[model samples]
Each structure stands twice: as C-alpha cells, then as structure tokens.
Target: MADIFSPSRLGGTSQAVALASACLSILLVLYLMFFADLYRRPDATESQVAQTLEGRPPLDIHIEMMSLDPIRQTVEARLNFPERRADAAQAGGARVRLSDGGFVRELHLPADRAAGATSVEFGLDGSISAYPFDVYRTDALIAAFAGEGAQEAPLAVQLTVWERLPAWEARVVSRPARPGEVGLPISIEARRPPAHVVFALIVYAVMAVIAVCGLAIGVLAACGVRKIEAAFASSLAGMLFAAPMLRNAMPGAPPLGVAADAYVFLWVQVALMIGLVLFICAWARRGSPP
Candidate 1:
C-alpha cells in the first residue's frame, strides 16, 4: 500500500489515476456547459395574422416584457412591428387592457405611427399576488387594423408571471390554437432567475469549489505531497460546514425537502461527506499531522 504513494515506486500508476480524475472533471464541466440550461427563464410568444388584403403586406407583431418589479407588480414592455408599410396608418394602433382582479397604471404607447417597421415602449402595473408560487397572469387586449379593409385583429395571450427576484423557478403557460385558426401563437419568453434558483446555483458553486479542492488533494496525495494534502483536507472539512448555511441565507427560501433539496442539495451533501471521509483516510495513512 505504501508503494502506491511512494515517489520512486508505482509512481506511474498514481500519475495515471490523477490524470484520469482530471480528465473526468473536465468532461463533467463541459457536459454541464453544453446541456445544462440551468438558468433559462421562459417568456415571449408570437402569432401571425390570418387574413390579408389583396395588395397589402403581411403583418407580424412581437411583444416582450422585462425589468419586472415584484413589489409594484409591474413590467416594462415593448411592441414591435417588423413589417414596414408605405402608409403609417396601415401599421394600425394597439390598446392594453387587463383582466378582472388586475389593474394597469403608468401605461404609455403611441396609438398611431408613420410608415416602416416600428416599435412602441410601455409600462404595465398590475395587482398580482406572488406567494406560495402563485403566477400572476393578465391578458393585454391588442387591437390593430391592417390593409385597406381595416379588419379587426385581436389576440388572446397569457404569460407566466413570477417575482422579479433572482433564481426562482417560474411556470410558463402557453395556449396554441389548432389549424384553421387565425394563426398559431409563437412566444419568446424572457428568462429571470428567482431567489430559490439563485440559492441553488450558489450552493452548486460551493460544491464546485469543494470538488476542486478534492481534486487538488487527490493529485498531491498521489505524488506523495503529504503536507499539501493534509492542508487541503483540513480546508475541505471546514468548507463542508459552511455549505449548508447558504440555505439559511436564501431570501424567501422554499420549505425544506423540496425537489431541489431532495435531489440536488442532498446529493451534494452526500458527495461532500464521501469526499471528507476519503480525505480523512488518506491523511491518516500519511501517519503524522503536517
């Protein structure tokens, strides 16, 4: 067993193991980068106008909201008209109306426009309750007239709303119409990190630091750097105690034993415990405190 840690004996095997561990760590990080949409937030939707005039251009509308304020229950929104037209009136006008049990305040947008593709900016303030993971959704009645006939184009849209806090998981609900309808709704959702999600990410960051420390210790121990291994092992143990405190620091933290805790947090804790034990064993084998 001593030969495994000896610098002049079985050194090649130890080096190989260290190399393999490093490679595995790098591959894991790469996998996370490519496949993990961990912080993705869902927002935005789109739809096409069904009927068109004989010689009029097709009309497309894109709406987006951002800079959400949880306390005031408001969002900054933009309406974009991508298709340019020769007549400014051909682009038409829009109005935003809220559903029952909701209110809109401080809203401003141009009702008329000149020719060419254009965008209007506005703010929406609503009465929304964001507690116990409730979604505050309201509809904006958008009316526009297009072509020479001045047809009525109406859209019924819904968006998943959440508190503007960083890192929490918010639900996205979209209703797409079947064929033969005006057009299918195409949405582009904006991502916002909630508090819980941010906390989880922080915890994962600490776990990553622990993993780096573990890797360093493993490599050093393989090369018989006893003092360095002991130092890193002690640091690793100290970090283990600090990791759980992050949960307590989370703002508006969800109740314990949620899926994130059960799946991610618990697994991270278990891995840390195992790493601690291995460090202890390796330190003991070195026979004497550094």
Candidate 2:
C-alpha cells in the first residue's frame, strides 16, 4: 500500500522537484496578478447622472435631498417654489405639472397640499425599480412659473418623480419640513463580486496539484527524460479540470463575517496550497514507474 501523502518516501528527486515547483508557482502567481486589473473598480465621481429636463423660465427654486432605500423600492423627495396667489389684481397664479415618458415611472404626490411649498414622491417598479451598482437614479423635476402685475400668481411647487417601471420599483415618502429643506432621495447599490471563499479549498488543492505536476512533467520533458512522460500526461488531465474551479472559487468565498476574520481565511488558503503541492509532488515521485 503506497502512502501517497508521505513526503520522505518520494523518490530521490527532491532537488529537481523543488526548483521546478518554485518556478511554476511564481509564473502562475504572476499571471493571476496581471489578470486582476480586469476585476478592479473604475475611478470616477460617485455621483452619477439620472435624468434631464427642460422647462419655461421665472421658476426660481431650491431642492433638498433625503435618504433613499432600494430594498423597499421607494424614493422620497421635496420641491420648493416661489409662492403665488390665484386671485389678485393682474389675474395671475403659478401652474405646475408632472410628466414622464413611460420609463417605468411612479409618482407619490403629497397627501396634504398647501399654498407655499409642497412635497411629492415617485416610485418605480420592476427591474429598473432596483438600484444599479455604479449608477444612481436621476429624476428631472421641471418647474414653470409665470405671473403679471400686483398679485403675481403664487409660485407653487409640483413634486414630479419620473422613472422606468417593471425593471424597478419606486416608493415616495413626504413629510413636513421647514423651508430650504427639500431634496430627491437617491438610492445607490453595489453589484456583488463573483468569488465565494467558502468553497475555495477544493479549488486550491486541485490547482496546486495541476500546476505542480505540470511543472514536473515539463521539466522532465525538456531534459529529454523518458520516464516522466506518464506523469506529464496525468498532470495535463488534472489541469483541465482545475481551471474552472479557480474562477468560481474566489467569488463565492464567504465574506469576512467579522473584523480581521479574513486574515485567518487567507492564511488557511496559503497553507493549504503549499501543503497540497508538496504532497502531490511526493506522491507522483514515488509512483514513477521503475
């Protein structure tokens, strides 16, 4: 019974194996380091554009922003406009309207309307309802106010929130607040990363074996060593099954459940890979045909 895990029993090829393993390990690590750039986050302003609107003049306004919640699928906003009176000498008053081009949009108007400033909300449903990673929703509110003479029509504000529905869900909340405090609630979420560390051990073991064996076989072949042909064939077959495992291994790796916990997991991976390579090399050496 050959104990494949015994390191000392591996044939008298430790020197050659060590040299080959070190070179192979460095090369594979370097390849991964180069490819890591593709997975990095882009550098740019955190605030992203959402919507654009154009309207008439005379509407001087200020906006106050609030918090946004994507899990609940809702956005709360407030709009403040110049005051206006409908009945006065120069027949005037401010008129406000809300509009959206059916971009999965929903609006929640203030339950209570008043003369000075008003609050409104918009909700989106479906896919667009959810917040996107690296992008924030932008709602365009257009306020058009015009009046002539003594009693200028009161400048009233209309809270119009427009968004695409189905692709997302939108909710609007309104509350009374002092003047100079009104804004649109914007929600931003990050896209999830792919590797999951929890199931990574299996992958590490598999890759170590493949990479180490490949190195062993390659070295033997380059030196015109005939006996290594069988080991080379096995190494090639093992590597094919290991590639996909590495791709999925990191994304699903469990997140650091607590602070500093990731360090423990990382060290474990390092140790496991080292142990696996040494064990595989020893076993392969011992198994070499007489």
Candidate 3:
C-alpha cells in the first residue's frame, strides 16, 4: 500500500492535474476581474431643439445634472445659454419644468463669461429613480421666454444631458418636437457597475487562495508526500470553512445564489469535496486505523 502511494509510483500525473486545475482557476479569475461588470445598472441623458423659425437668432441651451443622491433624491443641475442669447433668456425668463412638479431654484451665473457661454446653476429636489442594483431615468422640460409669443421666432432651444455617475454602458435618445410641436423630448440611458470593482477582485483572490491550497493538498496526497491524515486536514480547512468565510467578507454582497456563488464558489467547493473523498478513500484502502 505504501509503495502504491509512493511519489515515484504516482509520477507525473499528479503534477499535471494540479497544474491544469491551477491554470483554469487563474483564467477564470482574470475573466471575472477584467470583463465581468456583473453589477452594472442602466441610466440616460438627452437634448433637443423644438419649434424654431428660419430667421430667428440661434439659441444654444446646455443642461447638466451631476452628483445625484439616491437617498435624498436630489441633484445639482446646470443650464447654460449662449452669451448672445443670455439677454433674451434673462428678459424672456428661463424656467425648468420637472416631470414631478418639484421645485428648482435658479442660481446666479458668474460675471466671468466664456467667449460664448452663459450659465445658470440650480438644485433639483424630488423623486430620483434609483432601483436596487442601480438603474435610473428622468424626464423634464425647460422653457425660456418672458412675455407673449415666447414660443415663436427667436425663441431657440437646445438641451444637453448626462448621467450623474460614471457608467459601464450608456444610451442617449433625442426627440425634437416637429415643425409646429410644443416641447422637446429627450431620453438618456446609462448603466453603472458595482461601486467598487476592487472588492469583487478581493473576494476572488480569497477563493483562489483556498482553491490553490486545496489543489496543492490533492497533489501532495497523490504523490504520497504524507499520509491521508494531512490530506483530510488540508481539505477541511481550505474548503469547508475558509472558502465560505472569505466569500462572506464582501461588503453588501448579494445573497448566496448570486452568479459568483453559482459559478465560482460552487465549482471550488465541488473540487474540494472530491479531494476530500479521494483522501478518505486512500486512507481506507490502506487499511489504516479509523
């Protein structure tokens, strides 16, 4: 029995199996780290011009919302106009029309002016759509003009929009009202990944460490480096408790049935289980004391 489990007897097979398993595990980790964006969520921003006359002064409108707060449902929005049209906007008066009828306070634009840009900043408060797993979208309108016929000639409009957070993927759709239509329609879609991708990498690292340890134990057992006792101890320590504990260390991790659990942890645990069984069988086959 001892001769059967000897290192010379086992030869290259054990080393090859261990090498293959380690390589596969490493590839899996790299794929998940670089390309997996598992927690990405969708959002959007858009702009358009509505109802313009051929001879009217060209008006440029810029709108941007940033630093959105999901808990407070608030955001900082900025609107900019061409210096050429600032006077018209001020005289005509500019206003933001929110979909939810929320209040927006217009801020003073600085005296320092860019070559052609005039800007007004505002704070927007209301329901911001932030669903679990991170998805967001909003619809609103801006109208500028002080008195009558503001909707007609010289009342040019332009809008620019964007997501508050950096996105893994994004889409923008703009719909300008037809020749005689009333308002401009725009839509924005953006997807953001989990807040910190590094965290996911950390979790994978932990799993890799335990998995490697388990694989090493299997190789050692096959090479007869030690009796079955060492194999059983290593497998139990590396898989039964350590792997799960490491997985749970991720902050605010999804439940046990998430993709990582199913794909990564499940495979590692199965391999460890098989290693454990192999060690037990080897011990039994040797007719060693229970």
User: What are the runs in model 1 whose C-alpha is more than 4 Å off?
Assistant: 1-8, 11-53, 57-62, 65-76, 80-143, 146-184, 189-237, 245-258, 267-290
Better of 1 and 2 by lDDT: 1
When 1 and 3 are scored with lDDT, the better candidate is: 3
* Per-residue C-alpha lDDT of model 3 across residues 1-290, encoded as one tens digit per residue: 99878897687768888999999999899767655555343334463545354554434566665454444544445555556555354433433332323443332322245333334323333322222244445444444333335353324455555434442333435555435434444544443455444566667667866666676666566667766664465545558577788777664444576556666788778767766666665665663565
The most accurate candidate by lDDT is 3
* Candidate 2 residue-wise lDDT, 148-221, digit = tens: 34533333343333322222223222333335422222332222222222234435545555555555555544
Backbone clashes per model, in order? 21, 54, 10
List TM-scores for all candidates, in order. 0.37, 0.27, 0.45
Best candidate, TM-score-wise? Answer: 3
Model 3: residues with Cα > 4 Å off, grouped in runs: 1-22, 25-55, 72-75, 86-133, 148-154, 161-172, 175-181, 193-290
Determine which window of 10 residues in candidate 2 has minimal summed lDDT. 126-135
Ranking of models by lDDT: 3, 1, 2
Better of 2 and 3 by TM-score: 3
